[model samples]
Structure formats: C-alpha cells, structure tokens
Target chain A: MDTIVAILAAAIVAGTPLVFAALGELVTEKAGVLNLGVEGTMLVGAVSGFATAATTGNVWFGVLAGMVAGVLMSGIFAILTLNLMANQVASGLALTLFGVGLSAFMGKPYESVTLAAQAPLEIPLLSQIPVLGPVLFKHQILVYVSWALFAGVSWFLYKSRAGLVLRSIGESPESAHAIGYPVIRIRYLATLFGGAMAGLGGVHLAEFYTPLWVEGMVAGRGWIALALVVFATWRPARVMVGAYLFGGVTIAQFFAQGAGVTITAQFLSSLPYLATIIVLVFISRDMATIRLNAPVSLGRPYRPD
Target chain B: MRTDKRITRRITGLAVGTALGLALSGAAYSQEPVKVGFVYVSPIGDAGWTYQHDQGRKELEKALGAKVTTKAVENVPEGADAERVIREFAAGGYKVVFTTSFGYMNPTIKVAEKFPSTVFMHATGYKSAKNVGVVNARFYEGRYLTGVIAGKMTKSNSAGYVAAFPIPEVVQGINAFAQGMRSVNPKAEVKVIWVNSWFDPGREREAANTLLSQGADIITHHTDSTAVVQAAEEKGKYAFGYHSDMSKYGPKAHLTATTHHWGGYYTKAVQDVMAGKWKTTNVWGGIKEGMIKLAPLNPAVPKDVADLVAAKEKDIAAGKLHPFQGPVKDNEGKERVAAGKTMGDEELSKMDFYVEGVQGKLPKK
Candidate 1:
C-alpha cells in the first residue's frame, strides 16, 4: 500500500512538468502559433530556477525566476516566427539547440550540489487519510497548482470568449487578422504564457522534483510534454490524462521492478518511453481525426502580405 | 538584361567561394592545443566521479606545467550533447578529451573519429580505440569491506541496497556486498531496490525509506548522491556510504564509506601521458594501490567490531585477503569459487553471475 502511494507521489511530481509544458503548448497552439521550443524553454527555465535557488536559497523566488527565463526564451521564438516570419519548425529547432547549449553552460556551476526541492503543504484533515493523504495531499504545492492550472486552463480554452478568439486565430489567422483581432499580439501573449508555464515546469524539476540541477536533467520530459499536447488532442482535460498516463508508465516501472518481476531491468526502465512511442503510433492510426484536431497553421509562420 | 544576369551570377559565385573558404579554415583550426576536454554526466563539485576526474585534470596541468593546457565542460549529457561538446572541444584545439560516463561510449567514439588527433578516454565504458581508452576504478573491493561492517552492525539480519542501475559495476558491488555480509553474518539477507537513476535524491530517499520501513537496519547505495545516507539518518537507521565520505551528510547514519580515491589513478595516468609512456590499456586498481579506501567507522560501532574490520583492512592491504576467496558457493549451494583458489581480475570483470546468498535476480545487460 505504501508502495502504491509512493508510486502515486512520484506520478504527481514527475507529471508536474508535463502538466505545465502541455498547458503552455496548448495555449500556444490555440493562438495559432506552435512553439516547438517547449523543450528548450523548459530546460533554460530549469537552469534559471536552479541558479536562483542555489544563489538565494529561496525556492519560491527560484520558481518565479524560472518562469521569467522560460518566458524570455519563448519571446525569442515569438519574435522569429511571429515578427520575422521565420519557419516555426526551424525556429523551434534552433531554439532547442540554443537552449541546450545555454543551459549546459549555466548548469556548470550547479553540478553535483544538492538543494531542497519544494516542501509539501499539508492540509490538516485531508493529509490525515491513510494512503490518500500521502498521495494527494502531501505533495508539494506545485502539484496542487498544476491541477488548478489545468482546470483553470480548461475553463478558459473551452468556456471563455478569449479562448474562442484564440482558437479562431489558430484555425484562420488571415481572417482573424482581417477581423481586426490583432492575431500577432494574441500569438505573442499566448507564446509568453506558454513560456511562463514551461518555465514553471523547469522550476518544478530544478526546485521541486530533483532539487539538483544536473545538465539535461529535464531529460526529454519537455519533448514528452510537447508530445502530450498532441496525445491529449489539444484539450486540457485530456492533457491531464496523457500526462498522468506517461507518469504511470514511469512510476509503474519502479514498482514492477521493485516487486521482483523477472525481467531485464533495462527493458523495464525503458518501458515508459517505449510505451510512449507505441501510444504515438496508435494515436496516429486515424489520419483524418488527427488532421481535423490539429491546428491549421501549426508549424507555418503567418506573414500578413 | 545580359549585364544584370552576369552581375547576379558573380554575386552567387562569390557567396559560394566565401562559404568554402570559411569551412576550410574552420577545419584547419581544429588541430590546435594539447587540447584536453572532459565530458561529465554529473557536475564537478568538491567530490564524486566528476570531481575526481576534474582533480585529475588539474593534477595533469600542474604536472605538465606550460606543456599542457586544459579546459573542461562539465555536466555533459550522454548522447548527442556529448558528441557535440566533444567535437567542439576537439575542434577548439583540445588533443585529449575524457568523456566520463557509461553512456558516452558510442558518442565519444563518433567524436574521436571526426577528430583523429584528439585522444578520448572514457570512464566505465567497454568501447575503446587507438584514440580512445577506457579507465575504471575497482570500487567493488571497498564495497566488500563496507559490507563486512554492514554485516556486523545489522542486528535485524536484513540489509537494503539502493542501487542506481543494474550495470555490471553496480551488479558486482551488490553481489560483493552480499558476499561479504553473508561471510560474516550467516543469517543476513540483502534486499535491493533499483531506482533506475543515478542521482535523483527524492527517489533515492524514497528507496531508502522503503528499505528502512521494510525492516532493513543497514543500507548502502551505489548511486551518486548522499541522499540515501541522509534519509537513513533521518530514520535513525544505519547505512554505509559510497564514492565519497558521506559521513558529513549524516554523521550518525554513516557506518563507513567505501570511498573511491580517483586522484591516484588520475595522477598516474596523466603522469604516464606526460612522461610520453602513454599506452592504451585497461587499468583497474584495488585496496593496495589506495585507489579505494574505506572511510572511518562511526563512533557508535563497538571497538572490537572496529578492530575486526581494521584487521581485515590490513589483511586486504598486505595481500593476505581476497574478497572472493576460495570455497564460495552459488545461491543454489553449488561450488562456485573453488577452495584454495581466489578469483582473479579476469573472472571478476566478467562476473555476469551472482555469488551464493544473493537473493535478487541480476538483470541481463
């Protein structure tokens, strides 16, 4: 039972980055801009968050600092794709390369030094329950905030007027621009919001998850989060499911291995990612469905001629 | 119209010419410096794998004086990033690059091929080349001694190991620790929890908590961080430290650390290179060469127990002791290490099977 709770606890912590990054991408795609720099942005955010926490020893400020770093990186993407009319895919790739180099350089000072990840905020009544207490209520505040962000984002994307406009811009940017909705401005805002969330995800890793900022510590989670955007069909609620599903894949490997199941440990360790690829293949079986749900101008730069 | 076309053609020709010249010059500039670079999976703090390697790099520099210049990029990831960093270092005139991490084997090989003059030394990897050499510390010997301590101290007769990966190095340590423990405490059994990561402290702590909660009084880890020892301390349990003396992390918790003295190996290897006797060979040293040392036993240990371990240590140094001596049995009670014969380096390196008394399964690599 404790093992199950431990697995759930790991799920929330590991899934936090996915929640934030997926939400960020969800917003960016909704605004008609696909920022593939989500991975790079989150990596930079992690380094920035870790750098701050290491220097100041305040975990919250480190989180804010991470968000800012992520937002800044996203701003670069926005400028290239939104203002300069560069190819979104190419720009995102460059962003990833640049972010990897920059974060590696920045993470040099922080290698091997340990820090405290965020502490959990225990609720008096909820935290007293046997297994659920430790699993649900005993997680760091970031876990709660991530779920809140998911609900709030779901409401905004599906139920709000601004979300409607965002979706409209994504579907038909020229028409949105023609209708005087400031398509570029909305994209910029969306990208920034995405960057902030991705940055928060980075901080979740550097400050809340591992508490030690190793180079490449995000370890493709940002990319997984980017994939989660698609796996969830660009919907906030489904995003949660996909994130938790991947989290389950990771956490389950530990439990299965810990339980002394007779298998090569390497295969068990690779199960989460291997399962991801399988899921990706399964989801892509229906081309028409994916096409209909995908943002129309997802990887295309919009230039008002 | 003809003149305009000719001018456009001239501009295109000039652009191609410039691109070619830039590429050629970039290639030529890659051959500078007795350039040495090291790619570390973990950051170089005051101690650890990276720390020890960084220290060796410094030692190399001090030994060679102006003959050698060194610059390192730490915390490099194992895959493509490792290739890129090694290429950048090689391109920037570093002649020798040390890629320290198991996963860096293939990438280091690829980068070495691109820069033929650049020598690459990878730590804990099986692959090697004329330009690339592999070096590893014989840390299992120290683990064996620490296991003896764990064996003596565990009143509960159950010990826990928070292992990083099921790689041969880790598997060897787990088996050796179990072997040593069972040698002393006949009733002791070891339970292992594979965290699947090298340095995730939360996971390390979680693994420690699970082991402690499962009635394991003594714990040891093959992971990078001291988080396990810290976790043990918080729970008021006993545990052994690895790689570095982590008694500082949990003074009350650390029984003894199987500390790795990498500086000796580093200094020797670098000195060989400096003296122009650099030969590509597999170098693995144990207790005698001081590459591996056990940290001081905690004050909580009984003096007689400490004396017994100290005697064993002396025996190890004096060549009167071997961790895997004769008369060993497989888990099935079959004769494994025959009596009157000790296992040599060759047998130990390819130790794919477990010794007797190891309950858990060894993963297929």
Candidate 2:
C-alpha cells in the first residue's frame, strides 16, 4: 500500500510539468499554430523564475515572473513567424538553441543556488486520509494549478463560444478569416498562452521539482511534453492522462529498484523512454482518430489571404 | 577518430612552429602576463565539477595576480564545439589551457598540436603528448571513506548510489563504496540508479526519493546536481555531496562530502608555465597529494565511527591503506584482486565488476 501510494505521488510530481506544456501546446495547435520551441521557452522560464525567486524570495512572484518570461520568449517567436512569416520549424529550432545558450549565460551566477523547498498544500479533510492523503492532497500548489488549468483549457477548447471560433479557425484559417475572424491575432494569443504555460513547466522544475539550478535541468522534459501533445491528439483531457502515464513510467525504474528487483541500470533506465515510445505508437495506430482530432490548420501560417 | 588525425597533423605542424617560436622567445622573462584558458563541459555553477575548476582558477589568479591572467568559457559541449573553443583560445594567445572534462581529451590534444609553445592539461583523461599532460584525482578514496560512514549509519543495511554514467570512473566509485560497506557490515548492500546525464536535477531527485522510499537511509551520487543531497534532506535521510561541499544545500542531511582541491595544482601549473619549467606530466594525485579531501563530517555521526573514518582517511593519504586492496571479490564471488596485491591504477581505471555487496550487475556500456 505504501509503495503504491509513493509511486502514485511521484507520478504526479513527474507528470505535472508535462501536463502544463502539452496543454499549452494544445491551445496553440488548436488555434492553427505549432510552436516547436517549447523546450527553449521552458529553459528561459526556468532561469527567469529561479532568478526572480532567488532575489525576491517570493514564490508567487517568481512563478509569475516565469510566466512573463515565457510570454516574452514566445513573443519573439510570434514576431519572427507571424510578422516576417519565416519558416516555423527552423524558427522554433533557433529558439531552442537561443534559449539553451541564453539561460546558461543568465544562470551562471545562480548555479547551485536553491530556493526553499516549496511545501505541499494539504486539503483539510483529505489530509487525514491514511494512504491517499499524502499521495493525493500533499503536493506542491503547482499540481493543483495544473489540474485547474486542464479544466479551464478543456472548457475554452470545447464549451466556450470563443473556443468554437478557435476550433473553426484551426480547421480552416482561410475560411475563418473569410468569415470575419482575426486569425493572426487569435494565433498570437494562443502562441503567447503556450509560451506562458511552457514557462510554468520549466519553472516548476527549478522551483518545485528539484528546487535548484543546474545547466539544462529541464533535462528533455520539454521534448517529452511535445510528445505528450501528439499522444493526447490535441485534447486537453488526454494531456493530463498522457502526462500521468509518462510520469508513472518515469518513476517505474525507482519502483523496480526500491522493490529490490535488482535490475541492471542500463535496462532499467531505458524502461521509461521505451514505455513512452510504446504509448506513442499505440496512440498513433488509429490514423482516422488522429485525423479527426488534429487541428486542420495546425502548423500552417495564415497571412489573411 | 577524425580529431586524432587532426591532432597528429597539428603536432607535425607544431614542431616547425615551435622551432621558429623558440628563436623568437629566447628572452627568459617577457613583460606580458601569462594567460591561461579553461574549457568547461558544463556551466561553472557554484557547485559540481566545473565550479571546482573555476574555484581553482580564482585561486590561481589570487596566487599570481600580476604574473598571470585567466579566462574561462563555461557550458562548452565536449564535441566539435570543444575543438572550436580550444582552437580559439590557442589562437587568442593563451599560453596554457585546461580542458576540465574527460570528454575534452581529444579536443585538448587536437588543440595542443597547433600551438606547441602552449601547455595543455586535460583532467580525468589518459592521453598525453609533447605539450599535453593528464591529471586526475583518486575520487574513489573519498568514496570509500563516505561508504564507511554510510555503512555505519544505515538503519536498513542498504545504501543507495545515484550514478551519472556507466563509465569506469563512476563504476569504480560504486565498487569502492560497496567495498567500504561490506568491510563494515557484510549484510549491507548498495543499490544504484543510473541517470546517464551528469546534471539532471529532476531525475536525480526522483532517484534519491525512490532510494529513500525503498529503504536506503544514506544516499550518494556521481551526478553534478545537489538534488541527491537535497532529496535526502527533504526525506530526513543522510547523504554525501560530491565535487564540492554541499552541506549548505542540505545542512542536516549532509554527512561528509568528497571535494576536489585543484587550486594548488592550478597555481602550480601556471607558475610552471610562467617560469618555463612546464613539461608533459601525468599527475594522479589523491588524498596524499591533497588533491582529494573530505568535507567536515556532520555531528550526527557517532564519535567512534567518525574517528575510524578519520583514521582511514589518514592511512589513505599516507599510502598505508589502499581502497582496493587484495582479497577483493567481484559481486559473483570471483576474486578480482588477489591477497597481498592492491588493485593498480590501470585496473581501477577500467573497473567493470560490481564488488561484492552491490545489488546489480555492472551495466555494459
């Protein structure tokens, strides 16, 4: 029982960052934009958030600072791809390279410096539950915010009127623009949202996950989060599911080792990534489902023509 | 492989360049200050491996303020990029360059060829040349000392190691720790989790927590993150820091750390270059040479156990005690080092066996 609870708790902690980045990318893709710079954006966010928190000692401000940093970084992407209409793929890769180098440069002084560990928030009644209490309720506040973001993203992508237009634009940006929707403006907003969430994911790593600065501490989670979006098929609900699944796989090595399985490190370390590939393959088998779910105008640039 | 050929070509070119340079540099003392360069594989964050080298650089500057000057470029990936940076430094007229990561061995050699007048020092590598020198610390000595402490402190008779790669260096540390554990308690076992990367805080934290949850009371890591020690602190367990003292990061959780002191070496190398006494030399310095030392032990350690560790430390420094002495056996009970024979440096550098008391097989790279 304790083992199960511990694994489940670790799964949540591991997956929360993915949940945010994937969902944000979902919003961007849904609005007919594909920003492949999630990794870079998250890196910038991680350092900015860490620096802000380290200086001000205010957790909330640091988080907000991370979001703003992400937005600013995404804004650079929007200007390049949206204004100049450069190739999105190349631009995104450039952003990743830029973010990696810039963060390293900016974070030089902040190395080995750690923030005070963010305490988990506990629900009053749920905190008393035996095994599930610490597993479920005893998580840093970011976990709850991710859950709320999921619900909010779900509503905005499906239930709301604006979500309807966003979906329509994603389906055919030309048609949406012809029918009087400002496609480019909406895409800019979506891009900004994706960047903001990417920031949160990155900062979550530096602030809450490990709570210390290391060069490239994001450690390819941003790439995994990109995979999570494809695995989720652009649905916010599935993003959470995919995130947790990956999270569980990530912690499974620890579970195996802790359980005294005595597996070789090479074989055990490959399990999480292997599981991710298997899940991606399984999710991608249904071509019709992916075609139906993926935004029609995803990765397409619209210049109001 | 391509780097080797380039380096060879550079060496041939350097011979010609050196004779011309020698004629130009007949003067024993030049008015210009000696310049030293460092290429780091990762950022010189306040902790970890590069930070230690950076500390050495700072000390070098302090020791020879007017005689020498230093410059460093951090986050240099050890690949073609490393060659580019090293070449740039050599071209920039840095008289001595320190390539501070194992991965930078070939690049340092390649760069050293172009400028025979420049001296090169590569850390944790075996290859050396006319102008290149190999230098390493006996980190396993410190690991053995930490293992002794962990073995004594273990409440569950199990310790955990969070390792970076399956390289010989990391494998040696794990094996040495295991040896230390079994030396104290044959019942104790060491479980290891390899994270592959040198500095992934999230994975390190996850591995540390998993180790704690599984029953390890004491955890150590070869990774370049404070996450392992920090994880121990959060879980109210014990941990040992690496490369540098990390007690401040996990004050209560930290026991003793294995720290590298390169300041003395860095200053000596600079002084050697300035005095025209530099030569290609292999320096395998350990506790005896004061290259490797332990952080202050946590007060939580029992007095007798601490005293025992201190004595073992002294023995190691004085060359009276060897971490990999004879009678050592592999995890499978096959004897690797026979009685009366201590394991040699070459054997230790290529260590592939998990010593007895380790829970898993050595991962083949």
Candidate 3:
C-alpha cells in the first residue's frame, strides 16, 4: 500500500510538467496552430528559468523567466508563420533548433549549481485526507496551477465566443477569415500561450523536479509532452490522464528494479520512452478517425487572395 | 566574320569581369576575427564531461591572452549538422576548433581534412589526423582511488554507481572502482545504474534514489549533475563526484570527488600552439600527472578511513600499487589480467568488464 501511494506521489510530481505542456499544446492545436517547437521552447524555459532562480534565489522569478523565454521563442514562430507567410511546419522545426542551441549557450554558467527547489503547499482539510492528501493536495503550487490552467483552457476552447472562432479557424481557416475573423492574430496569441505553457513545464522540471541546473536537463520531456497531446486526443481532460500515465511509467522503473525480476536494467529504464512510441502508434492506427478530428488548417499558412 | 566574333567575345568577358569583382570584394571582410569553435554533444553546464571541456576553453583564453577567440554551438546533432558547424567556423577563419564529444570524432576528422590549416582537438576519441589531436583524462585512476574509499567506508557492503551512457570511459570507471573496492574490502560489491543520458537531473536523481532505496549506502556517479549527491544526502548516504568537485552540492554526503583538471592540459596545449610546436598528438594524464586528483575528504569521514584511502592513493601514485595488478577474472571466471602483471595504458584504455564481485552485467553497446 505504501509502495502504491509512493508511486502515485511520484507520478503526480514527475508528470506535472507533462500535464502542463500537453494542456498548453492542446489549446494551441484547438486554435489551429501546430507548433512542433515544443521541445525547443521548453528547453529555453528550463535554462532561462534555472539561471533566473539561481541568480535571484526566488522561484517566482524563475517561473516568470521561463514563461518569458517560451513566449520569446514562440514569438519567433509567430512572426515566421503569420507575417512572413512561411510554412508552419518548417518554421516550427526552425524554432526548435534555435531554442535548443540558444538554451545550451545560455545555460553554460549555471551547470551543477544546487539551489532550493519549490516547496509543497498544504491545504488544511484536504491535506488530511488519507491517500489523496500527499498525492493530490501536497504538490508544489505550480502543480495545482497546471490543473487550473487545464480547466481554464478546456472552458476557453469549448465554450467562449473567442473559443468558437479559434475552433472555427482550426476547422477551416479560409471560412473563418471570410467571416471577418482574424485567423493570424488569434493563432499568434494561441501559439505564444502554448509556448509560454511549454516553457513553464520546462521550468517545473528544472526548478521543482530535479531542482538544479544542467545543460539539456529537460531531456526530451518536451518531446514527450508533444506525444502526450496525441495520446490525449487533443482533449484537456484526457491530457491530464495521459500525462500522469506517462509519468507513472517514468516512476515504475524504480519499482521494477526493486521488484528484482531479473530483467536487464537498461531495458527497464527505457520503458517510458518505449511506452511513448507504443502509445503514438496505437493512437495513429485509426487514420480516418484522426483525419476527421485533426485540425483542418493545422499546419497550413494563409495568404489573402 | 572573325572581327565580329572577337567583338562579341570581348563584351561577354567584360560582363564576367564585373561579377568576379563583386565576389572578391565580398571575401575581403571575412578575416576580421580569429575564431575558435566548439561543437558539443551536451551543453557545457552539465558538470560532467562538457563542463570540463568548457573549462579547458576558458583556460585557453587565459593562457593565450587575445591570440585565441572562441565560439561554441552546443547540443549539435552528431552527423551532418556537426560537419556544418565545423565548416562554418573554419570558413569564418577560425584558426583552432575543438570538438569535445565522442560522437563528434568522425565529423571533426572530416572537417579537419577539409580545413587542413585549422588545428582541431577531440576529447576522448581515437580518430586523428595530421591537424587533429585526441586527448582524454585518465579518470579511471582517480575512480580507483575513490573506490578504495568506497570499499573501506561502505557499511552495507554495497556501493552504487550512477552512470551516463555505457561508453568506454564510463565503463572503465565502474570496472576500476569495483576492482579497487574489492582490493580493499573483498566482500564489497559494486552495483551500477546506467541512466543513458549525459545530464538529466530528473533521471540522475531518480537513479540515485533507486540505488539508495536498494540498500546502497555509498554512491558514485559519472553523470553531469549534483543531483546524485543531493539525492544521496537527502537519504543520508555517502557519495563521490566526477568531472568537477561537487562537494558543494552535497556538503555532508560527499566522500571524495574524482575531479578532472583540464586547465593544466589546456594551458600546455595553448602555449605550444602559440609557439608553433603544437603537433597533433594524443595526450593522456593520470594520477601521478596531477590531471586527476581526489577532492578533499568530508569531515564526517573517519580519520583512519581517510588515511586508509590516502595510503592506497599514495601507493598508486608512487607506482607501488596498480589497480589492475593481476589475477583478474572476467564474469565467466575466465582469466583476464594475469597475476602480478600490471595492465599497460593501451590495455586499460580498452577494459571491457568487471573483475568479479560486480553485481551487474556490463551493458553491451
């Protein structure tokens, strides 16, 4: 029982960043922009956030730094896609390469420095709950904020007027533009938000999870978050489940080694990544379903005739 | 007809001459700075491999004054992109380029051949050319010293090693450490956990915690973060560091760090290059050479414990001791290093297994 509780606790903490990133990407995709720069943007956040937090010894500034870093990188993507009329797919790829190289350069000074990670906040009654207290209520503030962002993104993408237009643009950008909707402006904003959220995910990994700075510390979690979006079927609620599921897989390696089943340990360590590929393959099997649900103008650039 | 044809050819020649003039002027401003470029597989702040290389670069700057100028593009992909960055630096008039990751070996060689005048140095790689040199720190010697301490200090009779990729460097350290541990405490066993990444603090910490929970009281890591030390400290376990001294990360948990000093080599290499004596050659430094040294022992370590570890270090340094000094057997009980026969540099460089009492298999990579 303790092991199960421990695993769940590990899952929530390990998976929080993935949950945050997937939610952000879900919002961006719902608005019809496909930014494949999630990995690059998150790494920028990780390094920038770590530097800021280490220099100031303040967690808030670290998170802000991460958000700003993501926005800045995402803004570059926005300019190429919205203004320069570049192919969205190609621009997103460039954004990733740029983010990765830039973050590595920027993170050079803070390598190996240890700083205080974000501490968990305990709510009075909820914290006293038997198994759920530590699992759900005892996470750092960012974990709770990620859930709030999920709810907020879900409502915005499904219910609000702006949400409707964003969805319509994703469904058919030309039709939305014909009806006087500003497709480019809405996408730029959504892309920036997605990038910011992905950045926050990176900061969470650097600040709260490992709680120290290392170059390439994100270690393809941003890429995992991208996969989580597909696994979640582009739904906010599903994104949360998918993130924790992947997170659970990350924590399971410890349990597997402890169980001592005589498996080569390296293969056990490779489980989460292997699971990611498996999930992607399973989800992509139904081509018709995916095609029907996928954003129509997903990676297409629009130019007025 | 001949006169008309000559007139037409002269007109064409004048047009081509104007284009040639523009191209020559474009090339004139390219030599403003003497560029030095670094291509890295991992980022510099990793506190493990790349961190030491970056320190070497800094040393080059101090040793050469303004004669050297450097630029690095980190996290470069191993193949074609690596060639592009090296060529870009070479074309940009970079006089010297350092490619500091193992995977960058072949790509660096290819680029060095193209830019024959540029000097190139690769870290921990075998491939070399007339203009390229290969250099690697003898980190295993220090690891063997640290192992002596681990063997003496472990109350649980089990020492854990958190490692990066299963490259020869990491593999050698693990094997030497196990050998050193067994030499002192015959009952001790080394358990290794490979994280398969150069620097991921999350994975590093997870690996550390896993080892601690599995009853490893003492730990050492070849990863690029203090996360392992921090994890060890959080669990009140003993640990050793790599690349840089990480005592600061886990002040109480740190036993001794097998610190790699690149400044000595960097300073020497840079000075020779400036003096025009920098012929490309492989430079390997070990315990006696001061390139690899142990960090100061933590106060919590017992005095006798420190003395015992120090005595082993002295023996190795003074040539009275050799970590691989014989009667070594592979996992299958096959004889490897013969008794009383000290392994040579070439042999040590290609070490492939644990010398018995190692609890895990050497990952075939």
Candidate 4:
C-alpha cells in the first residue's frame, strides 16, 4: 500500500510538466493554430530558467525567465506562420531544430551545475489524511500549480465567454472573421500561451524535477507532451489523465524492474509511451467525439487581408 | 616604353623578394603544430564520461602548448552523423583523431581506412585497424573499491545500481560492485535498474528513488548524469559516483567515486604519433597504469573500511588482487571461474550475466 502511494506521488511529480505543456498546446490548437514547436519552446525555457535561477539564486525568477523565453520562442512561430503565411508544419519543425541547437549552445556554460532541491509543499490539515494526503498534498509547489493551471484552463476554455469565441474561431476562422472577431490576434495570443506553458514545463524539469542544468536535459519530454495533447483528443481533462497515466506507467516499469521482474529493460523503458497511447486510444474511440473535439482549422495559416 | 618596362621589372623584383623572405621564415620554423581532433557522443557536461575525455584533451593542450593544437566536436550522434564527423576530421588534416564513445568504433575504423596516414584512437571499443587503435580504462577496478565502501556503510545490507544499458562495460561494473560488497559482507545484495539512456536525469532520478524506496540504502549509477548522486543526497542515502568525483553533487550522500583519467594515456598516444612510432595496440589500462583512481572516501566512512579499501586498491595496482578473482559464480549458481582461476579480458568483455549478491535476472537482448 505504501509502495502504491509512493508510485502515485512519483507519477504526479512526473506528470506535472506534461500537464502544463499539453494543456498549453490544447489552448493553441483551440485557436486554430498548430504550433508544433513545443519541444523547442520547452528547451529554451529549461535553459533560461536554469540560467536565471543559477545566477539570481531565486527559483521564482528562473520560472519567470523560462515562461518569457518560451513566449519569445513561440512569438517567432507566430510571426512566421501568422504574418508571413509560412507553412505552420514546416515552421514548427524548424522551431524544434532551432530550439535544440539554441538550448545546447546556451546551456554549455551551466552544465553539471546543481541547485538546491525543491521541497514538497505539504498542505496543512489536508496533508494529515492517511494515504491520500501523502500522495496528493506532498509535492513540489509546481505540481500544485499544475493542478491550478488545469482548473483555470478548464474554466477558460468551457465556462467563459472568451472560450466560446476562441472555439468558434478554431472551428471556422472565416465565419468568426466575418462576424468581426480578431482571428489572427486571438491565434497569436493562443500560440504565445502555448509557448509559455511549454516553457513552464521545461522549467519544471530543470529547476524542480532534476535540479541541474545539462544540455538536452529536457530530453524528449516536449514531444511526449505534444503527443499527450493529441492522444487526449484535445480535451483539457483528458490531457491531465493522459499525462498522469504516462507518468504512472513510467514509474511502474522502474518499480517492476526493481522488484526483480524479468521483462526486457528496453521494452520496459518503452512501456510508458505504449501504455499512454493504448489507454487514450481506447477511451477516445468514438469517431464523432474525436471530430467534435479536434479543431477544424488547426495548422492552417491565417492571414487577414 | 623603355621606362615602362623598367618600372614593371622593379615591381616584379619586389614581389619576388617578399615571397622569398616569407618562404625563408616558414622553413626556419619547420615544425608545425600537430592537429588533434576529438569527437564526443555527448556534451562535456560539467561531469561524466565525455567531460573526462574533454579533460584529457585539455591536458594534451596544456602539456604540448605550442607543439600541439586540439579541437573537440561534442554531441555527435553514434550513427551516420558520427561517420560524417570522423571523416570530416580526417579530411581536414587532423593528424590524430580521438573518437570517444563505444558507438563510434565502426565509424572510426571506416574513416581510418579512407585516411590511412591519419591515426585514429577510439575509446571503450574493441575494434582496431592498422591506423585505428583502442583505449579503455578498467573502471571495474574502481567499482570494486567503491563497492567495498558501500558494503560497509549500508545499514540495510542492500545497494542499488542505476545503469544505462546492459552492455559489457556496465555489466562488468555491476558484477564487480556486487563481488566487492559480498567480499566484505556476504549478506549484502545489489538491485540493478537500467534506465536505457546514457544521460536522462529525470529517468535516472526516478530509478534511484525507486531503488531507495525498495530498501536500498546505498546507490550508484553508470549513466552520464549526477542525478543518482543528487537523488541519494535528497533521500539521505549513500551513493557511489562514476567517471568523475561527484562528491560536490552529493556532499553528504557520496561515499566515493570511481574516476577515469585519460590525460596520461592521451598524452602518450599523441607523443607516439608525433614521433611516428604509434602502433595498433588495444590498450586497457587500470590502477597500475593510473587510468582509474578512486575518489576520496567520505569522512563519514568508518576508518577500518577506508583502510581496507586502500589496501585492496594497492593489491589491485600490484596485480595481487582481481575484482573477478577465484571462485566466481553467476547469480544462477553456475561456476564462472574455478576456485583457483580468475576471469580474463575476453570473458569480461562479453559479460552478460549478474554475479552472486545481485538481485534480479539480467534482461536478455
């Protein structure tokens, strides 16, 4: 039972970064823009966040720097795809390549540098509950912030008036534009938000998850998060579930190996990716639901004459 | 017309004089610096495998100064990109090219064949050609010593190893560590977890934590990050660092480390190439050759344990002690080495099984 709790706690910790990145991408797609540069944005975020925290000795400043870096990265994507009418797919790929090289170059000086471990924030009274308290309440501040982000994103996307306009624009940008909605501007905002979220996720990895700066340290988490957004069928709640499910599988595989399971390590290592895809595919099998959730105008370059 | 001819002749004379003077100066300083190139599989992050090789490159530069020039290209992937980088160095007139990763073995050989005049040195690889030589350190020697420390310090009598892959190099470290642990405390056991990546800190940390939660009070890793050491520090568990001294990453948790020093060997290889006496020998150096050294033990280690490790290290250096000495047995109770025999390099290179005291079966390919 204790081991299960430990695994759950670990899953939450691992899933928080993915939650941020996928949710951010979902918002961007909802605005009819497909910014596939989440990987690159996250890389920039990880380095800038780490560099700031290392120099300033303040982690919050690092977090701010990461988000800003991510925003700036996505802003380039916005200008290219939105203003210049460049192919969104090509631009996103370029962004990832650019981010990979840029982060490695920027992170050269800060390699192997360690930071003070981020302590878990225990919620008073609530943290005293038996198994749930330890699993849910005892996590780094960023983990809790990820939950808040989910709540805010859910409210913003479904419960708010602006969300309806955003959805309409995603479904039919032409109709929305005809109705006097600022299509390009709204997309720019959504893409920028996605970049910020990706950056925050990167910062979470560098500052809170590993607490060290290394080149390519964000690894392929950005790509995983991007996949999470899709496999969740573009729903905010499903994204959260997919992220935690992925994280849970990852930790469970390691635990299985430690417990002397004879499964091949290579297969076990790939289990997280496999499990997440399988579970998400099974849940979102209805064609109608997928079509309804997917933004119709996603990845289309929008230029207002 | 006569004056024009005279002026042109004077201009030609001046140009020739300058050319002759420049040629004379170049001849006087005939010894051009030897160009050395390094191809790394990963970035030379502050510590780890690539960083140590980079350190060796720095040593070569400092030692030779004006007589040598060195260039290192880091983060070269292992396949086609590695071949391209190696070929580039050879074609660019680098006299000595060092490919510092096991995956670069085939590419190094292929490039060496194309540039027969250039000398190529590949690290941790067995393949060698007329121009391609191999060099590796017996890191298992140092692992055994660190294992001794872990065996003594662990209150739970079980240790954890976060490994990158099931390659022979990593497998040797795990087996030697278990052997060293059991040599002192027979009840001590080791649990192995392979993260399947050389430098993913997030996964490495997760593996370390999983090991710690599974009742392992001491931990170590063969991956290219300090994540395991840092995890041990955070969890208040013991950890042994690999490739470099990671005491700084885990001031309290680090018991010691098994560090690799390629500086001395790299210097010798370059010097041999410069003298045109380099051979196609596979060099595997250990404690005696100053290729592997144990990092200083933590102050918390018991005095008796530290002294015992020091004595054992001396025995290893003097060829009186072997990590895989007599009576070695596989975890399956198979006799790997007879009571009076020791495992040789050939057997060690193909190691794929766990030795006694290690918990879990080796994940088969």
Best by lDDT: 4
What are the DockQ scores of the candidates, in order? 0.17, 0.59, 0.26, 0.68
Higher-ranked by lDDT: 3 or 4: 4
Give one digit per residue, the lDDT tens place, for model 2 in B184-205: 8889999888776787889889
Q: Residue-wise lDDT of candidate 3 within A178-271, one digit each (tens)?
A: 9999888898889899999999999998887777766567788888888778765676776777777777877777655544334666787778
Task: Tell me the alpha-carbon RMSD of every candidate.
Answer: 9.5, 7.6, 7.5, 2.8
Could you tally the backbone clashes for each prediction?
Answer: 2, 0, 0, 0
Candidate 1 backbone collisions, by pair: B35-B94, B35-B95
What TM-score, over all chains together, does every model reach?
Answer: 0.82, 0.93, 0.81, 0.96
Provide the TM-score, chain A, model 2.
0.96
Q: What is the alpha-carbon lDDT for the whole of candidate 4?
A: 0.92
What tens-digit string does per-residue lDDT give for candidate 4 at A1-305? 98999999999998888999999999999999988899899989999999999999999999999999999999999999999999999999999999999999999888867899988889999999999999999999999899999999999999999999999999999999999999999998999999999999999999999988787777788899889888899999999999999999999999988988878889999999999999999999999999999999998876665
Greater-DockQ candidate between 1 and 2: 2
Q: Which predicted model would earn the best DockQ?
A: 4
Please, what are the lDDT tens digits per residue for candidate 1 over residues A1-305?
77678778777776788899999889998777878888889889999998898899888888899999998999999999899999888899899889988997888777656674355799789999999888889878889999889988988888999988988888888998898898888999999999999999988877776566666667677788888787766768767877876777777765564445567667776787777657755765577877776788777778776
Question: In angstroms, how far off is B234's CA in candidate 3?
Answer: 4.4
Better of 2 and 4 by DockQ: 4
Candidate 1 ranges with C-alpha deviation above 4 Å: A274-292, B1-43, B59-135, B154-158, B162-165, B193-219, B223-241, B246-256, B265-282, B296-305, B332-334
Docking class of 1: incorrect
Error of 4 at B228 (Å): 0.9
Q: Pick the candidate with the highest TM-score.
A: 4
